[model samples]
Target: MLLCFALSRCAVSPTGDKLYITNLYEDKLLTLARDGTLLATFKDPALDGPYGLYVTPAGQVLVCERLSFSKLQMDSEDRSKLATLATRERDGVRYPMSVCYSSTTTSIIVGQWVNDNILVFRVE
Candidate 1:
């Protein structure tokens, strides 16, 4: 399938106070202040290699990793740990490279890196 890919490697919170960035080679996620000061760095077992990111309208953070069995993980509201959004099989997408949430449609959209495909999951 011919699909458009949108990389989401960095994002700013809805409040505009913080920035979230993924280090593609280091397997780490960084949180920064608007002034470019590092606030925190997170490393999660769920993340193989961080690639892309998406911040929800409500300020929720989601990450896309590069491994074949990669994930779409949501950052806990406290910005501490990452929680998997769904099981691997249920995600139905491989090699995720981008993530986005649609409030109007109540859905999650995923883009792949290894292949030209986009996955859309409705959120209830």
Candidate 2:
């Protein structure tokens, strides 16, 4: 038997002409053209088993690791490791399943898998 894989999360490009998908098992962010052709991939070692991805208005990509409990920046052209934010007091419930930023980009909304609630935070 063979197993087929598919996209787990998707983010619309800034121009809305492309789509970015995170492949969990592959640990890569695949860029697909509007017509579904493979365009490019923004590779990052930090993307190991990445589950959730958040794109800022400034075009910054944040990758959330479900097993590592770390958040990494995806700006590395060569996929270098960035700062690893450890789990805090607020993350006691479970690993983060999803994340989002406010319009101003001064806050973050985290959705945990175990809690099943959205946690809001102010960016300092």
Worst-scoring 10-residue span by lDDT in model 2: 67-76
Per-residue CA lDDT of model 2 for 1-124, tens digit only, reads 1123745677765666667677777777766788988777765654566677777676655555664334434432443445555354545525677877787758777787766667666665
Off by over 4 Å in 1: 1-8, 68-77, 86-88
lDDT leader: 1
Displacement of residue 20 (Cα, Å) in model 1 is 0.5
Query: Candidate 1's residue-wise lDDT over 36-106, tens digit each?
Result: 88787777666667776888877777777654323333343444543566434766557787788998899
Go through the candidates in order and give the C-alpha RMSD of each one to the true structure: 6.8, 3.9
Clash pairs, model 1 backbone = 8-53
Error of 1 at 40 (Å): 0.8
Name the regions of candidate 2 deviating beyond 4 angstroms: 1-4, 68-93
Steric clash pairs (candidate 2): none
TM for every model, in the order presented, reads 0.78, 0.67
Candidate 2: TM-score? 0.67
